[model samples]
Target: MPFTLYMLALAVFAQGTSEFMLSGLIPDIAADLQVSIPAAGALTSAFAAGMVVGAPLMALLSRRWPRRRALLVFLIVFLLVHVVGAVTTDFGVLLATRVVAALANAGFLAVALATAAAMAAPGATGRATSVLLGGTTLACIVGVPAGAVLGQEWGWRSAFWAVAAVSVPAVIAIMASVPGGPAGAGARGAGGELRALRRPRLLVALLLGALVNGATFCTFTYLAPLVTGVTGFGAAGVPVVLALFGLGSFVGVTAGGRLADRRPRPLLAVGGAALLVGWVVFALTAGNAAATVVLVLVQGTLSFAVGSTLIAQVLYAAVEAPTLGGGFATAALNVGAAAGPWWGGVALAAGFGYRAPLWVSALLVAVALAVGGAAEGVRVRRRAAGGAGEAPAPAR
Candidate 1:
């Protein structure tokens, strides 16, 4: 991978850390802000909502700008937002800061993915995209845990400060490493690119991402309660189990890069199947600490492993607007993020078992697999009809 890609990855790592660490600090936030735990979680949901709105808005607004400049501008916005988050004590102010951070974070990654595709050699597109996306995986492993610990020790504000500090070096590296140029030679801009939304394949990829994320989060959002309620464990053990999940996610994301580079179809199929199996195992083993730990790891792995391929699928489908395509994928994931917690919370309210969400998650993955199969068939037919010079289909 290029150094520029690494710089972009670093920026993503910091942002991901900022986002996920909120889960660990929810109690602290609730206590400090004098709100209910569920209310504090709305802070996280607010960020997700911002991402849903921000991704496409930023993509459309900046579609004509040079990618390098766009990235730099967004990173600056990211840093400023974090600064606002760290300094604010008022609940409303903090919520607004989180929204700003989400906008910058979502926009930066979308542009970074498009830049990765533009930077790569013709045949190395998947690998390049993977390098950029892998930052999220790395963050889950290292950035989030460290941030959680920082928040636990020094307060949640300190954790946001740490994330903000990272943006300085990220900005320096991005400025020094990424070359400036005119907008990409092939990518369209503004009004011309809006039509890319009409593509069926693009819609398929977006829905696939949405479904997969919705399934994963349905279980994940309630994991702490499930772990404690079913296994009769205390709060102390939850972090250790969650860390194990992060470890598995890191391994899966790295492995997925290699798999996507070689056999994307089989990798996606296996990932989808793994999600179903993992969720089933989770539902069955909810009462066994050891078994739940193993299942959590597997669930994390399968949830993350298909990320690059699914994202690559969207970009390939919307070749005319790669950044917008990436933005769409982010928007879809955020929509799923919102949906998952809502549905899972509903199940909890309905007096279903804690494991009900996992069962629902399994069904969602099964649906995703069926959708992916249909998409694969369409791609195969498209390839057969397309000329030899046509672009290869995206991985899903």
Candidate 2:
């Protein structure tokens, strides 16, 4: 509920836009740089790979730094990289900038999550995290499309320039609003945080979170092809359907935030099952354009409602880890984000129909549920023996 949380959310909006906007700029970048589209697309992969590696590493390196300082430094570096990316004439320079920018993005997001959750009162961490995530979803709805339009009208470089400019206000907000204390001040140092990873319950939750996200993204990455080719929606209608999905995601985040801290297991159980069912139904109904449209919104809502819960689940599950907890959340999601697309591409290349990703998504969600159920079984036995297993891993 703090205004500072909103500012943190603003900071992530800038970062999230940078991540997704590259999809729109790929064609322009490839043509301008005299490279193949696939080569230009590598910029997106570089960013994902950077986030995947950088989140935990940056969080660890800055674990001792003041939270405000860490966030500000990341924002500055992010802004500078975008400026360099916009001005550079060489493809290699641009690629380097993407990786550096992603490093900054990951570091900032890691700290921001910790900062937001720490700022929130007890029982409100889920709402706080969702507030922050809402900004990222907003970027999907607004920022990515605007970047594409800017690239179309001006140049792809202009889109980069726009991203840099957007960060200026966010940087100012964080500098002015964010306090200078380290998150979880005086907690056990990085060693205690590292030890959190050894907990079986925490590890299972992280894997569950990863699988749910992998399912969400594997379907998301392939939605365009499925909508256009199988549903016969036509290329011009793609944005409309994608926008609907984005709106559904925003709604899901809002709803999930209110309920996640209250009863996460039931939430995950019901939502994950619904998501799995939705994916299967979508695959079967791909030939029906009207049904396909309805399913996009349904799938988006179910996927994010469950996915957002897992984000909160992981953060709480790694409570001893604090700042590292935030990094863990980011890293887990990006791992899925990276793998989903790679695996989806492989399916398509292997001659699986456009509908194949829906089935793939279903399998990922089913596995996540099975894993969650197993973890729940272990949790019950531990609780029955003694009340020792209820600290951070309680309820979820």
TM-score (all chains, Cα) for each model: 0.92, 0.97
Instruction: Tell me the tens digit of each residue's lDDT in model 1 across 56-121.
Output: 888766677787788889999889888888887788888888888899888888788788877877
Local distance difference test, candidate 2: 0.85
Give residue 371's error in model 2 in angstroms: 0.1
| Alpha-carbon shift of residue 55 in model 2 (angstroms) | 0.5
| Stretches of model 1 off by over 4 angstroms after superposition | 33-39, 182-185, 377-396
Give the distance in Å from residue 181's predicted Cα in candidate 2 to where it truly belongs.
0.7
- At residue 77, give the lDDT of candidate 2: 97
- Give model 1's clash tally: 0
lDDT of each: 0.79, 0.85
